[model samples]
Target: MDIQAVDRVGMILALFGPHRESVTSTEAADLIGLNRTTTYRYLNSLVNANVLTLREDRTYVPGPTLVQVGTYAVGRRDVLKVAAEPMQALARETEITAVLSLWGAASPVVAHVEEPPRLEVVVSVRVGMQLSPVAAQTGIFHGFMAGAPSVVRAAREMDDADRERLQSSAHATVRQGYAAQVSSRGIAVLAVPVWDTHGLAASLALLTTRDVLDVETDGPELAALSRTAETISRMLGSTRPAMTG
Candidate 1:
């Protein structure tokens, strides 16, 4: 409405940055040269509209509703239902361990994981179990470790330079058709990105554990995973899923 208001909102957005999680009203005011009272007024209005989110401690983050709306607006297509059968088939063939995961904001949750028939080797996961974004052997963290888009957003919690290095590795993970543990007791996972024919859509990945992967230096299994991802993609009507390379 006013010049002062416009300038303050612009400055506040810049401060929000990619990695900084939350900011205080007083801190925003001081940084942007607005009085604390004025800053609180603007922040309160944003919070009420659900444009911004505030914690119990009064710190702020991008609101949940806004995020969901933004993602949908960004044209992300959901492909899980189409991917289920293929995922099950892969698990059935290998009889090792496999999972499908997605980002749940702060962490990764196992959206779907196959139950191993061996009972003992079975790795159980639920609809919503949060995991680290950087762990090499786990859910969404592994997704991020494997370079999933969901994890890429979480990795923005780091500074730009550090984030750049990780993003490079993330891209590599997507291209390589598998993401490997830095060291083992190695838990290697083979993955493939399945996409809708439309370029602007969500992705699905097929995940398999270290055992089946260990038998391979030639990467035939990895290629199979890629093929599986492709099959899933075609089923979803994606004539062109985004290529890794």
Candidate 2:
């Protein structure tokens, strides 16, 4: 294999991150330190191979082949697989609904749910449900995670009071390594972050009635939840230390 060629391809791909979604041949050439003619040749080759798609304006975006390969890679090593056993054990231990939510393009979306065996009352959650920044404790991702698009969207939609409260909650979540909130219907929601090698990969959450579970900063449930989240994070290659309460 040509190591130099592979490294150059990796460099080109690394240019696409966070707010950057597209690149032109000229921009890629300048950023990657290549000559214009050489950059055009490389970009054209990538377009022919479907690794990138060239638009009318000459900007290149990730093509179908790139998207397919990315999706396949995530399917094999995503947080869902690493968190599954820990989430199931947490659900059973807490006797509450355990949820694994991934940070989506705009908000946290439910990726998985585990219900305790033989629970009389179960909180209903479905995969693909978009959790609200105001209504769901998982909004901590928007508040605490850097470069998330949902933060701007949430700030625009909230009033002064709600925004202040969310900011406060987000700060506390960072300090304590978890977020806790209660809904209008007296259901308690507690969430902790599950990190990967990069950063926060997902939120591990528990949902139960206020009577069934007390939401506390240093309570037993919070400790247990944090432990479970840490277990999953370690499995996903996170080296960050756990938050101590």
Candidate 3:
């Protein structure tokens, strides 16, 4: 593939994040560092492949096949089997409540969760429940399929700077298989990517209090979480994205 085509794909993927509406080609060309003609070609290719869709206004948004394939991929018995134990252990270790959420339009669906025995944390979703993708804890997920990157980047719901932050977070999340946040709620989570067979780290995460969020990886609890996350990744036939730092 030409380097120019590669650049266009990056831009298109970049544009899809955050923004909900189909984006104007002209607008996307400007954001992605590509000319209009090349931008449209990439867009059209993605559309044809069902990676993106063109609306009545000729704006491009994510298409159905992307979601369909992603859902179907995760639907495989093997995928769930791989994710189950790490999620349970994460909940037990933190005692702050834990859940495995799949990324979606603007929210996350609770694929699995282990609640505190006595304490109550207002979890936003049920086993299959979905909620916005912007929270501090939710950002620490394993998968990037199913509109995960898009919601983090260009959503109309978040301010431009905030969207960019999510975009950056997604980059690091996709790169390192982990993302962490200390939010206004004082909760902190360390998340890793749960990659698929393609080696695209999907989503893996750790939910804990801000107090223990920065625990060194050498520490027993943090080390255990790391091992558990890696075990899950191995079952998925993958590993965490390489660390750049």
Candidate 4:
């Protein structure tokens, strides 16, 4: 590999941090400590290569090529193969949508989703859709993913209360071995961590309409979700104890 070219590419890519979605040539030049002409040439090369897009305002953002590469990488994970049948059974048994998600650049991205057969009003989730890490519905990912603390810190415009709430949710998730939340949209989500030998592998979540979730007096739905997650964890070679939460 050409070291200088690799370094310049890495610097250019680093400029698109969570807080900085797009960058102009001058801005990237200053941040990357390169001359303006050189930076502009590099940006143009990236745009031509389809790694970055040149917007009308001359700012650069991640292009379709990068998204396609990310989607392809997500699809190649072995965990998706292990999770397929369990996720399907979870959706069928609970009559709720089941999602398998792995941590992505900014949040957890859905790798696979299974919708109930009779579900008329389907949830809009799809494979490769990025989910909010701070949202109550996605606490499991932030709670267990290795790089979650830095991601929480990088999240912009969060109030003190919101930060505290997210921190509390993470703690609760670890303590209980799972996380649950009822969104203001009247959507209920329950998530359990899937572990491999290395540690937390991913999150398995069940999504249901609030009405149906509220009516379930018995704990069977939650039990089923936990069982499925545990099965996946075992298949991934995890020997961790069963989730008590």
Best by lDDT: 2
lDDT winner between 1 and 2, please give it.
2
The candidate scoring highest on TM-score is 4
Per-residue lDDT of candidate 4, residues 130-242 (tens digit): 67656644577666763655455435335677767877898888887777777778887778888899887888888777777752332778789889988998998988865
TM-score-best of 1 and 4? 4
Task: Estimate the lDDT of model 4.
Answer: 0.77
Per-model TM-score, in order, reads 0.53, 0.66, 0.53, 0.75
Q: Give candidate 1's error at residue 154 in angstroms.
A: 4.0
Q: Rate the local accuracy (lDDT) of all candidates.
A: 0.57, 0.78, 0.59, 0.77
Better of 2 and 3 by lDDT: 2
Q: How far is candidate 4 from the true structure (C-alpha RMSD, Å)?
A: 4.7
Deviating ranges (above 4 Å) for candidate 1: 1-78, 103-109, 135-153, 159-165, 174-178, 182-185, 200-212, 215-220, 241-245
Give the alpha carbon lDDT tens digit for every residue of 144-164 in model 2: 584565557656567888777
